[model samples]
Target: MLLGVVLTVLCLPFLWWYFFLQKFKSLSAIPGPRPLPLIGNALDVGDTPTALFNNCAKLLDQYGDIFKVFIANECKVFIANADFLEEIMTSNVHITKSNGYYLLKPFLNFGLLTSSGSKWKRRRKLITPTFHFKILDQFLDIFNASSDILVKKLFNEVGKESTDVCPYIHLFSLDVICETAMGVKISSQEGKNSEYVNSLIHYFDIFIVRFFSAWRRFDFLFKFAPEYPIQEKYLETLQKFSTSVIKKRRLEKSQEVVETTSDLGIKRRVALLDLLLESDDLTNDDIKEEINTFMFEGHDTTASGVTFALLALAENPEVQQKVYDEVLAVVGDETYVSMQHLQDTKYLEMVIKEVQRKYGAVPFVERQLEMDATIRGVHFPRGTTLNLYLYGVHHNEKYFPEPEKFDPDRFLPHRQSERHNYAFVPFSAGPRNCVGQKFAMLAMKVIIIKILKTFKIIQVPDHKPQLGMAAVLKSYNGVRIRLIRRDTD
Candidate 1:
């Protein structure tokens, strides 16, 4: 009898919260898998990052644009359509980033990518001008130089009858990002045999591995998760690397030394490291966080995006030839592509946009709620999960027409993209959109230009590319393609 009373007391809050409270709410309109006892959608949200939320389209078709899933008793709302997305993203409602992003706090602190409210606002302002068009114009020199180094490396391998371009691109991007972000030129194109690239990659590998570990999922469980050790080491590496670079640069500048050879140019006019160091209101930790964010952001996504685009081009040689012919006609035997040439590469630009539509390197963007809010006629209680389902929205046939078809013509002239606000958000939308987007695009343009000018991107025989979810979706096997140097030198 006494035991029965105690048990009843213990169960009452959960029983009331799960049964009486949720029953009154009109969740019937939202479609999702049935919730489990106490756990809710815990089973539905996969443990591994590889297991994507299943058949979201089928569910959206059945339930509607706005649907609910309960993970570990937390109610999550997934938005699919433009209007719903606009409400959340636009000023229609003051919806903030979801608490789900708190998980990334261990890996990335309150970096611009994962901060909220006024802090995010202030940080965004300081950093916004850093990536302005004029600043990025300064970065084009590094972009062109790095692209040349990468093309030369690939040409050397293709010269030796190589049968893949993916690994080569990844290596190339890493080197460029290293040079751009840290202002340290490490030749990742030369393999891990080099000390600097090896140290950087060593830390980078662990950082990515830490992002998707099981500890991240059940973050509320452990006293201190395994990511703590991982992050400590990551920060250690970052600190050591940044400190050394800063010290070396100040020393070099003090001595008034000019450093470099013919290809690398005599000086670096501007770089990511310089931006962070120059930006006021950013403390040492803030600088470090920004540096870390830029380092990861600078390389992987751009590399993966380039790989996907190159693969798409390889699969459709007609399109590749079109791009090649456009380069020939427009640039007309220019040894190096200039910024003006990049602007004229309209077909190339269209192709990149189409690639982003078809295979965006990142498939989802997450945000937390500021307070209790309403979304799509539903009152979302504070701390509910809201996701802008990137893949679902991107592939929706209503927005992209024949969504699967690879046609750059879809983004041609006279077609105002204003018709669809949230239809195709490869880099997301609004003010919080990617700060490094311009930087990434410029890098890809230079690399693609130089590579295409020298070698034609070709497919390889054992072209089985499989992707596993890391910080972003990336090739586990690397993109396998052979770059056949044009004119066959």
Candidate 2:
């Protein structure tokens, strides 16, 4: 009798689950990798970040643009079709981010990137104004100053064979975000690594590891695991750094009078942190989450974008010369790259756009369906997680002919008009797209124009990097470029 009772209790849950899954019989008709009886296709999923990324690519190739895969019996639909992506991105009901983003909760703690519902809506409203054109214009000075330091650092390696520009650009971006976002200067270009920065990198690495490992997804198991202690240590480091900066900035704000006018009768100075601090609806913890989010998003995304842009320029000398010529024509030996210069360098902008299409810093965006919806006549039930494969879409030959080739002309005004709006979404699309995209583009233009004007980037021979998936898209081996100094006329 005892044995029968135990079996009946266990069978009840399984029966319930089996019946629950049956209601989604419509989704079962969608083709995907064959699943095991209980664990489904979870074991077939890759164990490492790179493996997982590669597996997704392979599945897309085999299963076509839209297909399903079971992650421990939960059906996930991967969509690479541009139309489907547009439908998903534009839908108001599907605005909530996927559960996968919850992995960042321990780090970001309901920052704009991870929050949902009314909190996300309110936070988005509060933060959107911080990246206005006028505000970002003030940050140009910060961008130029940091670029000057980066150029000086690179000059030390001029004509001394190939140097890995990845670390240098990473530090340059770090400094830019610090000054512009946090209203503080870390001078990371000086080559002195901070504990905060080291911990930041370590935390991202740990997050990726934990994200891919099924065993670590369970809170109880991950908490007791050996990796948990290391993760906690880095988490503490990040929290400590962010909180300290917030408190320091708060103290400064408290001491200063609220100035409504500048020397030129313009509006007062605005920093990202200041905007957050001024909001009555937010607390110190809210400010910290946003600070950490901006620091991570603003710095790392641009770093990857700029690094890949440099790599592309190095591989294509003709393209590099064109950008250099455009810079010279636009700015004409001016030590400073102003907003006018940024606007006038149209060719350089196309090159950057092409680079983003080929190597977007963010490879994918995930969304969870809040209600049942039909995308291109296919039904997706509520609670289904959708992975919008931006990278795959960018590489799809149907959208971009000869996708492997680096061609900036693809983004010419005429050419862009011919393509689908959703085809090239490096910053994503629709309402929840990246808020600071303009700021990022302006910063990249300033730095790239500085570097290209100073030196001709040369690609190392036989050195195509194998990219790995982390929080951002990164190469297993760092991006190495040889710099040949340009003749001063």
Candidate 3:
């Protein structure tokens, strides 16, 4: 009886796969790497992070526009065409995030990034007002202050050998997010290591590892894995830190008595957290999740965007000069970058757009089908996951010719007007696009302008870093550039 029971258990998975999972077989018609019975293309897609990233690029090169890849019999259809992306992203039924985002749930909980259905709708509505032009304009003081610290920090590195600018840029972005989103100061620019910051880095590392390993996806297996203890420790630290900040802010909100006036004579001192605190429908957990969400999204993504912009500029001196000229022409010798200056820096804006096109911070956005839908004459049944490859789309030669060249003129108004609306989606398109995009753009513009006004970025010869995928797009080595003080010139 015992031998019979063990054999039955062993046969169950194969029986289920044959009787239930294989019946649909809609994806078999889609072209992709051949799959084995149970582990479909799992071995083909490498298990290590670097190999996985390379495998994705290789697959895109081999399979044009759209194709399928199975992760343990689960069909993930990768769509690289602009029209298909528009159809998928704009649909109301496909608004739910994919199962891959489940890895982020431990950190983000039911926050906007991971939430779905009515919960997402409600959270989005509640947080929308916090990014209004007026509210974001109020954060300019924080941006300006942080930019000053960043400039000073970079100034110390000037005339040295080419330095990896990623860490400094990361810290600057971190300080801006903490101050603007949480109304707290961590002084990350002071060059002291932050326990909270270190924990966040480790947390993301484990998240990447688990995301690539199918076995780690199961809670039972992950709980006993070697990395689980480290992940748990960092998660606890992050949660503890965020909870303490939220509680303190809540208490201060109850007794706060001060208000400051802006240059426009408007009384203001608001944060994203303050907006959440105003809503009666939200719980403490709700507020904490949102804070953590913004903290992660706002800082890391911007750092990638800005760091890549610098690298691109360093490689193209002529483009860098044009941006420097534009900044001087617009904001010349100003102590701080103003909203008016941000609006007027047209050439700089083009440069930023080009950077995002070449190196979008978040390489892909994913969605899962809640109902069967046909897109572009192709039918995708329910339970199918669509991986919208933003990086692939951005680099497609048909959309942007000579796609690898770093040319800012590609984003000129007339050129941009002629392209499809969805062709260049650095911030993505459709209803569920990034809410903090304007804030992110403004921060990037301010920081880039500050750096350009003070120094000329020069590239290290023949040393460009190869790209790698992580929670955000990153260089396997760091983004290194030499800063030559403009005062000397």
In lDDT terms, which candidate is top?
Answer: 3
Candidate 2 lDDT, 1-489, residue by residue in tens: 999999999898678667656655678767788866556677656777667677877887788778787775467887788998898888766788887787888888889988878888899999999888988998998899999999999988887678888889999999999878877677878855487777777788778877777778767888987889988998998898778878877776787632454335655456789878988889989998898889878888999999999999999999998998899999889989999999999999999999999998988888888888887888888888888888888888788989889999999999999999999999988878999899999999999999988988999998878786656788778898898888742
Model 3 TM-score is 0.94
Global lDDT of each model?
A: 0.69, 0.84, 0.85
- The C-alpha stretches of model 1 lying farther than 4 A from their native spots are 1-27, 53-65, 92-95, 156-164, 192-231, 246-265, 416-418, 460-464, 467-470
Question: Model 2 segments beyond 4 Å from truth?
Answer: 1-24, 257-269
The residue-by-residue lDDT of candidate 1 on 1-489, one tens digit each, is 999999999898678667643642654666777876666655565544444433455556666666777755456677777777776666523535655555556546777887767887888888888888887776677788778777777756674444556667777888777777767677767665255445455655654454444454455643376545655665566567766776565455446552332235565566666666665566656776676667667777898788888888877789999998988888888776777888889999989888887777776676656567766677766566677777667777677777768988877765635457777777877777888888888788778778778887777766766655544656666676767778864
lDDT of 3 at 158: 89
Write the residue-wise lDDT of candidate 3 on 1-489 in tens digits.
Answer: 999999999999878667544644766667788866677778777776566667877888898778788777577887778999888778777898888788988899879888889889888888888899998898888898998899999988988888999999999999999888887778988955488888887788888888888889777899989999998889999999889878877776677631444335666478788888888998789899999999888998999999999999999999998998889899998888899999999998999999999988988888888888888887788888898888888888778998889988998889999887888998878878899999999999999998988899999887778787756888878999999999997
Clashes of 3: 0
Model 1 alpha-carbon miss at residue 389, Å: 1.6
TM-score against truth, every candidate: 0.85, 0.92, 0.94
Error of 2 at 265 (Å): 20
Question: In what order do the candidates fall by lDDT, top score first?
Answer: 3, 2, 1
